[model samples]
Target: MSQKPRRQKHPKPPKNWQPPPDDKGTILVRRELDEYGLNIYEFRVLAHVARRESKAEGCYASQAKMAEVCGISQRTVLQALKTLCQAGILRKEKNEKGRTNIYRLNEGSKWKHPSELEKIRKAEESQEDELLNLI
Candidate 1:
């Protein structure tokens, strides 16, 4: 028997991305994550963890389930988890059953744009200048 073609998870966006005003926030998130270093898969993991169900005070997902939802291989999921953890974007623990690893997100951690770093540096410089004048 022949196997069906694999489904493509990240299809190109429509020619026109102008959505109704109500979907503006969702659009913004896609743009922001893209601006950052996250690819579609990475963003999905982050977005999922950011949701109420996933990021509650203490919530986690098994490596198996995460792999299924993210449509990636189990090994790929582990690598992604490592990247997220090193970036201070997610926290993880081994499941008690030893069957899977549990994943969580760090609430305060966020990826900032390169431009934002420049703005922060300029602000700090100005603040230092003002402090020097006062003294």
Candidate 2:
């Protein structure tokens, strides 16, 4: 019997191949966030903010710019920001000297997981239904 050769998991890059010039910087997102119930727009906005963060300035990108970079509407970006803030996954503060808001990622421990958020929503819905039945 002949044994077949094993395929490489990641093939090597081509010789003399250069990376793209307009490549944006990378963002490090924790694996735990996968269970945080974040929608696509929320995740995209978070990633864009993370990429633009700096030690001195933090992330102060405007909603319009974030929407442009994340390819979503400004209203969607605003809604995502609100949800992230409510979930304690992000902190948004007004810039004292500027109109744009400063955004920072909160500690992972502060984040409410998807399951917990879902439970809360279900409980609220049940309460509303019970109230309607009483009426």
List lDDT for all candidates, in order: 0.59, 0.75
> What's the CA RMSD for each of the models?
15.2, 12.5
TM-score of each: 0.50, 0.65
Clashing pairs in 1: none
lDDT of 2 by residue, 101-130 (tens): 998888788887666665654565687689
Model 1 quality (TM-score): 0.50
Identify the runs in model 1 with alpha carbons over 4 angstroms from their true place: 1-34, 52-57, 94-100, 109-135
Residue 85 in candidate 2, Cα distance off native in Å: 0.9
